[model samples]
Target: MRSAHRAPRRLTRRHLLGLGGIAAAGVAGLAVQQLRSGQAPAEANTSPGRAAASGAPSPSAAAGPQVVAKGGGTVPYRPGRTILGSYLALEGKAFTESIALRRRQTGRDQRIVHVFYDWTDTLPARIAGLPAGATPLVSWRGSAYSDITSGGSDARIARAARQLKRQGRPLLLRWGWEMNGDWYPWGAARNDKDPGAYVECWRRIHDIFAEEKAKNVSWVWSPNWNSAPVAGWNSFEALYPGDRYVDWVGVSGYNLHRETPDALFGPIYRAFSARKPLMITEVGSMDRGGRTKADWITLFAQWVEAHPAVGGVVWFDTDTHPGYAEKWRIDTDADSLAAYVAMAKSVRFSG
Candidate 1:
């Protein structure tokens, strides 16, 4: 009845010692606050104006179902031209790749990339290494997802929200994304495989963010495909917190388990259709499957085009799996690339 992974825990001494590489990574994390800034380190020749701009709000804004207040004013969430960007590994590559992708999407003309801000690395102790107003990290580990104060503390969440506001960027935050399944500590079914606590935790996280006046943030609530025996109708929605906290409805799905694109993604599309914008936060066809990248792209495009409510889809570019290697590439699969290009160009971005 359970099928998700748990959040990675602090490494043990043996693993820390044996896995010297990861140990160094941990230390590296602690070594410099700059590294946690979520952007490339500052250069010696940098100008002060640019540095100041880092603290300003980001220009890339979108529309969604939720509304946030800025300077005591309210705004709605709208979908933008979002490219599925990776964790830190793809941060730098985003600039070049995003530009190329944008160029390719000229026919469609959407101007944005829906990015994944890997909390551990990007949300550092200080902004020394980050660009300014970058992605903020709100995690679901501990009881943060189910018990607001259990994992995510109000103070910490407040600080992150304040920092993002100061930087002047709109945040598309997906906290404890795939909660229905059991892999993560915040998974809905963890204790008794029930979702009550999970919903409580989600509500709590929302309270903290809202009270803190983190106006530039847009919350995206996403869960993996419902593979549990009950077809994923877990009680997670009980914790929705409300339309106040959520701006978009999203799904972290893949072309795994013989799921038809529509079947796998339909529930979410229907669930949040009237209340919020919808997105495919993470998805890719695996290589091990008989499906080829071109075929997957065609299928995905055909499916997306059929859904008028679906605002956008962001492809998870990781090639870590078999059939997925060529999936995220912008050029390898001509058909897929062309489809993305077309969509990007056609969509109207929300600022």
Candidate 2:
């Protein structure tokens, strides 16, 4: 609905932040004028120029599916080249070791790292400190995922989105994650088993970002694997907010009981890959039964290479447990770290 102005595109978070951080201090004065003139920000029309020039139909107009790099930007996903990233800690201050060892082991570094911000505020500097090639994939969560919103709450979401858009580089954002599962209070079941509430909450958050014109974000809609013995089916598809509102379909699946990557991730992959880029956003192979973590890593790597629809893999780098025995940290078992490094080296990861 507005004329577009292109920000200078670059990949580094600091360089983008240097331009004027999240407040967009440098652009604010002009933004006020544009707002008074009833014009939208440039971030709103992010599709590549060729689509308009060539008169070719865009993905949304034609196929009704989305395959974007960031949320609305034109970067495409490359299967084997998707990012190899991690989130060692939710506390933004603690992941330096996660970044350090990764560089040491692979002779390279992570392409991205996961970070979180609560409804109240965020820490952009934490992400700005990542190694040269790494960027942050931030998840914005509030006190409760199911709580719809008040006027002020929407403003919080808008403020965060505006900050990210000011970062200039494309960033990954996971909002209201794992909504299909019953664990987090934000899940649909906790919100009275109302699928519409969940969908509405998601779109509400998405619409705020759009309103703020934060086109740099790539929306990752992640759901946990259906672990409930009987009620899983009713909720998985119901929670999907549709392809139009989603940038990537990510699933948080971990091997709890002697499972392979396919066994753990196949259903979610099959469910959304046809319509969007797939990501094993949060994954781990539990060290259980006589099987080693190395074997699981090997199988997971093979599956990633084989699954063309899979665009990225972000391991649950933390060793925290969910009733599993071994710490899920990649280095816990013998030769497992080596196996992981080999896997990282074997594949091509692009930022």
Candidate 3:
């Protein structure tokens, strides 16, 4: 694992996007309403001018729900079963030891292990340290969109793809995730706000992986639950690389404040649940504002049960920084750990 350096609090994506503010201002109430009504909030303007300014395709050109390609590379959809997983930060601890501790604490075997790599980093050999039968969900960050689409990153991408193929086991590859947000270099907001560039970049990499015959890899396309800029152009619809290129649709959502699972994932479930196998690619919560994490986890389990299209969830179970306001680790407290254990051990999440 790479050195554990935390992003400064001031520059954190959630803080910059005012998600906390939304929760503070009663967005959770609206989210509950949305969940009950099976409706999403009104979308932003999709006018041609806005699309052009953001370098996104017009709504007419954006792809909607359609029949997607299926094959050995895709994850098998199980209607009522979800794979429970987690991303463990090194945080000065040995990776294998950390996994062992997590297993002992949760009392359930994680089916997926989440790992991250930068655009220039090689696939770490340490993946072999993961528990037997656990699949790896690799979140590979990308460089600038133009750099990628222009073939400048081909060698690097092909190298990773070849490495994955050598693994000889099914793996989930999430490339350039959270592109709707402004935090990463590959995000549309940083790449001339051009969602088209993002799509091109993704397709180019997917093609390179195909050229490498990485058939064991399942492509995962993930975005933040809400756009950072909160604009139509940055919406998931505008940034989608289309169903044919995506094996799974995922979202990163966190209850940084008082937001509930319905508030965090309702809109995403409503939009793409029918189009692709949906997963909560990244999720966590902070106990705050008189809300208990235990109750929140119970509600989240119920929500997933009510929505059958969701087949996987990866918890962001790490406290990245000291004194962080959001203690995301599942075992932050005994109650939180108990709640997570119950969720992980439940038949619905049992793989």
Instruction: Give the poorly placed runs of model 3, Cα more than 4 Å off.
Output: 4-72, 90-92, 289-291, 321-325
Q: Which candidate, 1 or 2, has the higher lDDT? A: 2
Give the 10-residue window scoring lowest on summed lDDT in candidate 3. Answer: 42-51
Candidate 1, residues 1-351, lDDT tens digits: the string is: 000111233322121111011012222232243335542221111111111111112222353433222211122333332333322112234344544444455433222233333333234232222323233322323343423546646666666566656646554567766665545555555545556666666677667767877676667777664523132335335435567666667676654432345545655665555566666766665443322444555556656656655554655443222222233444445555654454344443212
Root-mean-square deviation of candidate 2: 18.2
* lDDT (10s digit) by residue, model 2, range 1-351: 000111112212221111110122223344344447664321211111111111111233355433333332332466447678876642232456656766777777877677755556652523545677565677665346434554546766776777887777777887767665545556665666676767777888889889988877788887764422124332556778887888888777665443445545655665566667877777775564333567667657766776767777887675432232346567775567877887788745543
**Candidate maximizing TM-score:** 3
- RMSD in angstroms, all models? 16.9, 18.2, 6.3
- Give the alpha-carbon lDDT of every model: 0.45, 0.58, 0.71
Instruction: Give per-residue CA lDDT, model 3, range 1-351, as digits (tens).
Output: 344212334456454223432332244454455547664321111111111122233323245433223231455667678888988763657777778888898786778888877677787534757788888898887788889888888898888888988888888999888888778888898988798899999999899989998888898999876677767778878899997898888888776555666656766766676667887988886664333676677678877877877888998877664445466788777877887898888899986
Give the residue spans of candidate 1 off by over 4 A. Answer: 1-147, 150-152, 227-236, 287-291, 320-327, 346-351
How much is the lDDT of residue 168 in candidate 1? 60
Per-residue error at 25 for model 3, in Å? 9.8
Candidate maximizing lDDT = 3
Rank by TM-score (best first): 3, 2, 1
